[model samples]
Target: MLLLNSGCGTKNKNSFESDIIIYGGTSAAITAAVQAKKMGKSVLVVSPDFHLGGLSSGGLGFTDTGDKSVIGGLAREFYHRIYLHYQKEDSWKWQKKEEYGNIGQGTPAIDGDERTMWIFEPHAAEQVFEDFIREYDIQVYRGEWLDRENGVSKSNGTIISIKTLSGKAFKGKMFIDATYEGDLMAAAGVSYHVGRESNDTYGEKWNGVQFGVFQHGHYFRDSISPFVIPGDPTSGLLPEISEEPIAPNGTADSKLQAYNFRMCLSKHPDNRLPFPKPENYDPSRYELLARVYASGWDETFDKFDPIPNLKTDTNNHGPFSTDYIGKNYAYPEASYEERKAIIKDHEDYQMGLMYFLANDPKVPEKVRQRISEYGLAKDEFIDNGHWPHQIYVRESRRMIGDYVMTEHDVLGDKTVPNPIGMGSYHLDSHNVQRLIGPNGYVQNEGDIGVKPKEPYSISYGTILPKKQECENLLVPVCVSSSHTAFGSIRMEPVFMILGQSSATAAVLAIDAKIAVQDLDYEKLKHRLKEDAQVMLLSERLK
Candidate 1:
């Protein structure tokens, strides 16, 4: 805990350090910083995004929390802040609270907890995140991306410092990798894996192999031409569908997850702006979608969950919707400009899709009008043309830590030694690849949805690397897990929950002058419980 200046022109050395340095501006990142601060440690949050919350404030107002009882500590405190904002009565501009009661995709609203509403408005969530930063007095450096290749420096398996893209060096006693990509952990020389592991590798029934499952209505029963030229092999597959055959059962391969816009639409005519035709709008790009419409598929508005006022968080649906099925392969490792181009491509594809449904002669009139009634909310995401700033990063580089949680662990057949948090969402991965079936029909692969019998404990070892790998880095957002296990643990609430626990462990490690992997679990658990973290089900009963 000393400030040093290694002066120029000499082998000069001085020390400058913080108790904890958190990367990423997601809700989880903020939660972790707040927890560290509450532990009387100085903390700083460096984020790639200018905005505070990741997806929670970035258009996904309707949360995807499975079991609300499991969300506690700083995560629960975040929602409570949202509830407090709404109590002002001025927060409800578009609709009343009574009209919007306990309605979401999978979870029920908790009547006793005012803060536990499963659904909310985008601005409300953002404000809540901002309030946390203000109240905790956490310092945040926005628009700063980490230089992953050489950003992290370590000695004796402990992180010495991390430098940003702008060469702004941050020296912290402990660091938390709260990014979805696990960039910090990877850069720090910790082992991690991208894409799925073959199911056989982990003996996981749901890990790498996914066959003959259609939970999201993304399969076609009949032959649909995937190209401009109908039924001609020479014409080749369309831009969206890949030429490669879907890998066989239990095979390990990298495939793109579906990408979609979390559209913030409104029925309020004053606030609604019709989906615009993107700059590079190509009608041919939507041939598969047109074919889907031709097949009597009419579930376009199925996921327009209501928020405050008449606003809705619109999502993808049917065989062809917001999810750009096979185009995100280059995204996880792409450059910033490349990521922008990919994002723009998705925007065009999705916007053109909306325009096609609303104005194209081929679309059924009823479906067109239903989609036409909705438009982007002018008030939300004003900085980004009312679109979601962050793409829904479903899966990324998962750290392979001391303990890797697998399907067996989530199924309650196995238990983790050091429990940090709990997650109950069904193991869910969106379709990974589009393929031609033996029946001469196009189909989607890698869509697995298996429900866990009960909520399972997330291992503390999953968040910390082995002592010899990297001692000071804690990965909360991208924890150690197989692809199948990550499916259940990837929820936003769970990330925030893990963030708090990770930060607690970071502070404790610094105080004990020990590596994060060597922190005493008894002390960690005691601090977590005192701070209202949900580490055990029996603790909740008490």
Candidate 2:
């Protein structure tokens, strides 16, 4: 088990420690706290975000729920709460449920026992997450960033307390690392791996074998010259296209998945604030996007699904879209100031892209006019001037825990014994890097999209570090998995389910006075079932 460094003093402040200490205000963190509270445990949720829900309330109103049945416990309860909110007739401000399209982008919206509208507005989601906190009367410390360098304290291979950046310290018998990047796991000195692992390492077909293959047909001809000299080595590659050969198949590398902001836009004239030219906006940075438009790519307007008030939750789609690929490699481990700079760079790039699409003379008139009709929603994210409060952190440092969930486990060949939750989304990895293909074509690599036959089990051991590595910490967001395997497990709903399970495991460990790695699977499973967690795939499919 990984042992954390003991602090200089032995005194534990705040004599009464909570049963569980969650170090984030994300959807996962809140869900974990709520679950722990339901089990009659004193729970405290400390978060860096002033808001409660992370991305769930942060402009991702159109949920990425694959198989909704697998979502149980606090996750299902969250949706149920949403349903109750809409039960009030006044909740439908702009359009009635019957008028709004229930289906979009291949996912169907069905009315269930709860009146919850699966897809909703950003404000509505935040209200539901807030209501959960109020219902449980859970203690919450907002704007508390973890002191990563030297804040965590431990005793005999178990964490005793963790101090936030503001110097406020919280001590607990059990700790749950629910942050997307696993900051607490790292600060607690747990073992973790970053970037992609080769197919050979896992003996899986999809892991690293399909690096440069673009199944979505998003690639373009390299012969079509962007520069004065096309393919000559002396001429140098274009702005976004890297000259490196797609890393050879079945080889481990440090490349990470792409990230982007989910823009909340609106067409309502009064509510919409027209896309503005960002500070330091450069026309030349969008040369690649200009070229894409020149190549007859007009699918940019396809992903704007309408929410309430004529607003849309715009997502990334097609080539040269919102995903600023290859620009976020240093983000997962960067300093706070550096992270701010990176977030600003992404904000500037995305905002400039919108402005360019709406105003640039080079863009096709129809595309320009279509994009110009929409703008930022004025009411949402009021603190950040209606911009998305959270950036979409697609993938980050994954713990190399006791049992690594490889592609085979997700594909159903290997049996995952202690299934804590289930994931049914396709193994979808966004483009890693832009490269020049052998046929003198400009191509994008690392965008692997493969369908799963059925929902697969997410192993319990994946949530905890190896028995010899870390003892008290439970990681739900960045669970142990191969790079490709993570693609399926990385969903909002699945994270919530795993969060509930992680908190349950933490509480069980606290009561047993044993390391998290030593918790009996049978007992844990029993507790999970008692708490309404769907631990098996068959239970969900049925």
Candidate 3:
């Protein structure tokens, strides 16, 4: 059922052939491989990461599901298996079953009758992903880096083969680009866009920089000084605050939002590891946070949200908190070495902030005493020094496919034709840059928060590239949409839903001998319904 026709080191140096080839180790990547096997296809998953389940198996235990009823098919089956894993008495090792009470964002946590759970620990999620590979006998080639420079061989607008750095080539009839950065999509000569577009470009209201529209408490309420010497401009601005000119409202730019690690922490004495100071630790970097704390800001512990067994999924809290803003604008297109340096910088900054708050003498004693109780969870992320293996890349390159989904599609103003999946999260984006405000103080910019009027249907055309561009490739993770529209449809559950749907379409195209754009939607919708995928909310809940 599965094949690896060619070997790299020990055997012949020929090309390997398969029906389908998926190139990523994300949660969507695993689910797509599972769907390919169930649909009777010989598939292979060649990933850049050693482990699977990108963010879901990372530290993001607190899911961002807006509506649970919209999840079905292989995505729903994944959670149901997690529910069955907890039914056993031995599964509760760190904490007892009763001690792990039913606490979650929505619906019953246990759901004893339905046999499904929506929340779990990082390792538990990883185990379920591993089980999917074992149960279906899916062939996975790990630690194989893509040779992006001179790797892909294309002819007549179709990919003939893709090679790795180790000199192994994979020849397939169809390919799927499931990476968050869309590296494979760009290599295939497909058109894509990066960063925010102007409001006039897509007739959108929240696609550009928002100077006066402060959505949450992320902005400063009172005027705070940016210089080290209060009321003096000669001492120079602090480290993190920017000095760039703020653009007018609704204007376009090429800057991206911030990124951070969703750290898993614990308060238990036996399972906690103290946060150590990094080699390049500098206390002066957090002087701005010290100023914010002195100016009536005490929300540091607001986002240390709990998960299970006394563990907390800590996230970005306030203005000068976990998010490393204005530092990741070059990450999406950077080289591998450059990206590693950026990741190290983020790790050092976050770890240094924790140590400063708990040990530094300049910090207020009241705030330091409360934060000293928490540390990294010792049992989690054991292979990676108790740090999360993945950093949250919120937005990245988006393919400009046949249909560019705009705000009108999600705002319920126009009907989304050829529905494939459903998404209901808020149209959310973090602060892009922190620059000087109007009052000679510092303020955050580009934090727009807008929710949909209702759960709108997603279009099938958004995932298909132009027929002239490439006929054998389908992009689901980086689908065609504007910046504001991708924000609402970029949830983890929705990614898996689209992953399974795209896999179904790939096998159907392979069998029918047609391009992905030329396939009939009526047949695709029927196949999706047969697999228990929820295409509409009204029909799904019933």
| Number of the predicted model whose lDDT against the real structure is largest | 3
Each prediction's RMSD over C-alphas, in Å, is 3.1, 3.1, 2.8
Candidate 1 residues 1-542, lDDT tens each? 22222221212232235678898988889989989889898888889989888889877877877767788888888777666776677777767766766566576543344455667777888888888899988888888888877788777787777888876777877889999777788889989887889988898777664757666565665567776576776877765676676566878876646767777788888888888888888787778777877776777788888777788877766666788887887777777788789888888888888888778878888877787778888888888888878788887788999789998988788867889888888888887877666554567787777888877889999998877788888999888898888889998899999999999999888788778888899999999989888876675522
Model 2 alpha-carbon drift over 4 Å, by segment: 1-16, 104-106, 221-236
lDDT for 437 in candidate 1 is 62
In terms of lDDT, model 2 sits at 0.80
Q: Give the winner by TM-score: 1 or 3.
A: 3
TM-score of predicted structure 2: 0.94
Q: What TM-score would candidate 3 get against the native?
A: 0.95
Q: How many angstroms is residue 293 displaced in model 1 relative to the true structure, after the best TM-score fit?
A: 1.5
- Candidate with top TM-score is 3
Task: Give the count of colliding residue pairs in each prediction.
Answer: 7, 8, 0
| Candidate 2: residue 41 Cα off by (Å) | 1.1
lDDT of 3 by residue, 468-490 (tens): 99888888888899988888887
What Cα-based lDDT does every candidate model obtain? 0.79, 0.80, 0.83
The order by descending lDDT is 3, 2, 1
- Least well predicted 10-residue stretch by lDDT in candidate 2: 1-10
The residue-level lDDT of candidate 2 at 159 comes to 82
lDDT of 2 at 39: 75
TM-score of 1: 0.94
